[model samples]
Target chain A: MVNILANPARFLRLAGAVLPWCWAAAAVTGGVGLWLAVFVSPADYQQGDSVRIMYIHVPAAWMALAAYTLVAVFSAVALVWKHPLAHIVAGAAVPLGAGFTAICLVTGMLWGKTSWGTWWVWDARLTSVLVLFFLYLGLIALRGAFDDAERGNRAAALLALVGFVNIPIIKFSVDWWATLHQPASVLRIGGPAIHPSMLWPLLTMAVAFMAYFAALLILSVRAEIAGRKLQALLVAAGRNEPAADGLQGEAR
Target chain B: MTAAVTEFFRMGGYGAYVWPAFAFAALVLGGMAWRVLARLRASEGALDRMRDRAEGGRP
Candidate 1:
């Protein structure tokens, strides 16, 4: 099992096979989730329609942290076990993670302003999340800085591991410190405090976001694998020999 | 039908914020998808051309 997963070609083939189902899952869940959040669910008695933002905000917030954890785990694999696909997975996921964090912050700002009358705050939860976004940006920049691919991958993976301390900070921020942000409504020691009417849509959107991430990750990883193959071909061509073997079926 | 449509569009007077929130989500996800597909296609094109050239540029 370990060897099977450690091989890049097998992983790439697996990603291709799983890609279509992931897209289908994302579309179905996203469509249904949006419908439930917008039309089927009742409005909050107090916050009113502004609560609609939760559908987008909550899922994005979930993904923001989740993606970083993924990066951290993959980075660990690359650094410790030298898994071939680990660094590629970590590097390719940065932009998507950054995007999710951006959505979370922006939607949070919108919700905050509508509810708390403030667009910006120095609260621990918000600040830590902002730091997470910047951490992703830094890894991306660090990866592109090195001319040698191995050195670049090593540096980025190391940074990913070092920066993983922020994930716990972001998750527990609302609890560890007093903040304007709400705390532990769904994923808590006890079951969800939210009503079923609201919880169902939120869960649906969460599934949609996870599906979206899976689909995007596979596509991005496939691109990364193809990119490395292209690079290998280029290097081989420098030796005045054919490099067509690596190019076969890679276009698909 | 008209009233229901209007109400839905209104989003209970939070239309400005609500609409933009969803729009941003769409933009982020959609933009990422577009970028990834472009990368895949570009790699595919380069690989195909290189392989063809290596095969004596045969059709």
Candidate 2:
């Protein structure tokens, strides 16, 4: 399947077919998840309604990490195997991952304000996630830093692989240090410590977030592919049109 | 019914933080979705126009 999808045309065709379903899944699941999170689930006995933030915060955080991991894995593939789609995918995923990280951080701060009685803390988990956010920004900046697009992609890919060291740090930070941020409840060794009342909605929101990310990733990848084709066409046109228009030729 | 709705929005006095948390999530995700879709539309439009120009100029 990976070998077959290495062909851009085949990949585009598969993406086109899968895109509609991803959008549908995102819409339906997102709506249902929101409903469950707001109305169906019971409030935390201690945290009260503030706990509702977890529905969005935790899921966005998960997607933020998941998306970065995606970029890193594909960057490695692009670097090692020299797959064409891999670089485009890694590049396309950066903005979405960054957006997710922003959502996570902001919502986390909001939750923190209500729970921890402060807006900011330099705890292990929080600091590491902040670093992850910066890594996302660095990848975006690195990708556009070069005149040659391929060179930029390679530079960004290398940075992505290097930045992946932060992922595990973010994951283990809560455990390894004394922090205001709580350790893993849902994704833990024994099992989820969260009650079924809360767990179901959390899981539902996770699905919604994943479906949303998948839909957006596919859309972004399509845009990147189209942009590349447009660039190629423009280059070809530039080569052809020089004798006809000297003014434009000078600009080129 | 109105009171109940108000209470739901109020969110047991944590409304300020909770509502904004959800709202920002919606804003960020929705805003990104719009941008991505617009980009796809713009690129596809450009590709079509270029293809048309190529055909017209060549033929």
Candidate 3:
């Protein structure tokens, strides 16, 4: 299945067909999620209305981890299978993951300021997540450092694999340490610690954010493929080669 | 609705921190999306220029 989908044209066609549905789902689900999060869920008794930040912060944190995991998985596939599209997918995921991670950090700080009486802390959870953010930046920078695209891809893939160790550390940091950040509430082994009303909206928002990431990732990958094709065409034109031949060579 | 709006704006006394955080998130998300679309458009334009040159100078 991976080899079959390795063809760029086939991937492009499939991505194009699915892209609209992904965007539509993101828009609809995000709308509903926001409605539920903002209006329906009751404010926390102690934290009051400031508790609303959980809706956005939790989802962003989840996506940050989820997106990095995706990049690492795809990077491994790209390295092992030598799939060209896998590198592009991994490249596209980095910025989005970084953005989500940034959001998580910022919102967490804000929540902390109000609830924990500090803007920041050097707790295990916060520190590990900061490392995760740096790992993302490192991958993005490494991708652009090498002139040879294949070498850059491989190096970045290796970095991603090495960074995979941090994801678990970030997840378990709250559990493993006396931290300001709360431990897993919704993802507990037995059942969620949250109320049904609050839990539903949080889950909805999480799904919506995941869909949003999917839509944005597809867009970024399509743009990357188009940019690669354009670069090849320009190179072919500069060499006085036929554009038709250039495109045909690519399609193969 | 009015009471909810007032409470949200006031953010239950943590308005300063809460509102700015939300605004910052919006800005970051919006800025990233804008940058992606802008880059895509620029690449498309470059492709069009390349295509035109290839076609026009075809012998």
Candidate 4:
């Protein structure tokens, strides 16, 4: 199934058909999620209205990890199977992942300030997430560092695969070390510990964020493919020559 | 609605932190979407320019 969907043209057609639905779903889910999170969900007994941030923070954090996993998986497929579309999909995911990671960091800090009386802490979970953010930056930077597009893709793919080691570290940081960050509530061996009222909106927002990521990622990949086509057109027109055959050319 | 709005903005006395967090998230998301659309438009413009050039050269 993955191999069959590797064709760029086929993927593009499928994405076009699905993109509208993804966007609509994201919008609908986000609207409902926000409503439920803000109005319907009961305030935390301890945190009060500030608990609302969880509606955004938790989903962003989830997507941060999810997006990185996607990048690593796509990278692996692109390398092992030599799927061209995989590279584009992985490359398109970097900015979105970085954005999600940033959201997690910023929101975590904000929540921390209220809960822990500090805006920042070097706790195990926080530190590992910070490392994950840097790994994303490194991948983004390495993608453009080579002179050959293929070389850049390969190098970025390798970095993504290597950097995946941090994902597990981020996931288990709270368990591995006593930290201010809470242990898993929604995902656990015994099942979610969160109350149903909070759990529903959280899950809804998570779905909304995932759909939003899908929509944005498809748009980014389409833009990238279009940009590449434009470059080819320019080359054919003799209006411009291909840039230096380095990794940097492929980075964008 | 007014009471809810007031309460939300109050953020139970943590308004400073809460509102800014929400605003920042919105800004980042909005900025990303805008940037992507802008790049798409720029690429489309370049394609148009190339097509125009090709047509003029042909005539």
Report lDDT (CA) for all predictions: 0.89, 0.90, 0.86, 0.85
**TM-score of candidate 4 to 2 decimals:** 0.91
lDDT of 4: 0.85
lDDT of 4 by residue, A131-239 (tens): 9899889888988898888899999999999999989998888888899898998888899988899999999999899998998898888888878887765564474
The candidates, ranked best first by DockQ, are 2, 1, 3, 4
Model 3 residue A42 CA deviation (Å) reads 0.6
Superior by lDDT: candidate 3 or candidate 4? 3
lDDT of 3 by residue, A104-133 (tens): 999999999889999898999999999999
Name the docking class for model 1. medium
Off by over 4 Å in 1: A244-252, B56-59
- Higher-ranked by lDDT: 2 or 3: 2
Task: After the best TM-score superposition of candidate 1, give how far the Cα of residue A196 lies from its true spot, in angstroms.
Answer: 0.6
Supply every candidate's count of residue pairs whose N, Cα or C atoms clash at under 3 angstroms: 0, 0, 0, 7
- Where does model 2 exceed 4 Å of error? A241-252, B56-59
**TM-score of every model versus the real structure:** 0.94, 0.94, 0.93, 0.91
TM-score of model 1 relative to the true fold? Answer: 0.94
> What's model 2's TM-score?
0.94
Model 3 CA deviation exceeding 4 Å by range: A244-252, B1-4, B52-59
Docking quality tier of model 3? medium
Q: Which 10-residue window in model 3 chain B sums to the lowest lDDT?
A: B50-59
